[model samples]
Target: MRIHVKLYATLRRYQPDLPRGAALLLAVPPGTTVNQVLQQLAIPDNVPLVTMVNSSVCRLDCVLAEGDTLNLFPPVAGG
Candidate 1:
């Protein structure tokens, strides 16, 4: 299956070849979970992930579907 991934904030470093905020096309097997995709992208487990699937917030174990647009952001911090 193919899914589009958008990385935000510090997580953007994972996609150095892509323009900031550009979507990346990724291929994974059917039934792949969001967590698996993050692992495949080498996103550190300790990095807080704020994820959205097709504009709706989702958890790491959420299943991915073909044509899904996944937006991932690192947790925002401010005083």
Candidate 2:
């Protein structure tokens, strides 16, 4: 299965050196969850962040489907 990954803010560091704003096409086994992908990408699971799929907030255990777009956002802080 293939999923589109869009890393925002600091998470953009995880993206390969490709064109800007281009979603990384990741190939994972069927039923692969968000947590697994984060692990594979070497993203620290301990980071306070939010994960969304197709614009909807989702858990790391959520199963991803082909063509699904996953976006990761780092925790925001403002005074």
Which candidate gets the maximum TM-score versus the true structure? 1
Question: Model 1, residue 24: what's the lDDT?
Answer: 98
lDDT of each candidate versus the true structure: 0.92, 0.89
lDDT of 1 by residue, 1-79 (tens): 8999999888889989998767999999999999999999999889888999999999999999999999998777898
Which clashing pairs does model 1 show? none
Each candidate's root-mean-square deviation in Å?
Answer: 1.0, 1.2
Q: CA lDDT of 17 in candidate 2?
A: 83
Q: Estimate the TM-score for candidate 1.
A: 0.93
Instruction: Give lDDT for model 2.
Output: 0.89
> Predicted candidate 2: what Cα RMSD to the true structure?
1.2
If scored against the real structure, what TM-score would every candidate get?
0.93, 0.91
After superposition, which runs of candidate 2 have C-alpha atoms over 4 Å from their true positions?
none
Error of 1 at 18 (Å): 0.8
Cα displacement (Å) at residue 42, model 2: 0.5
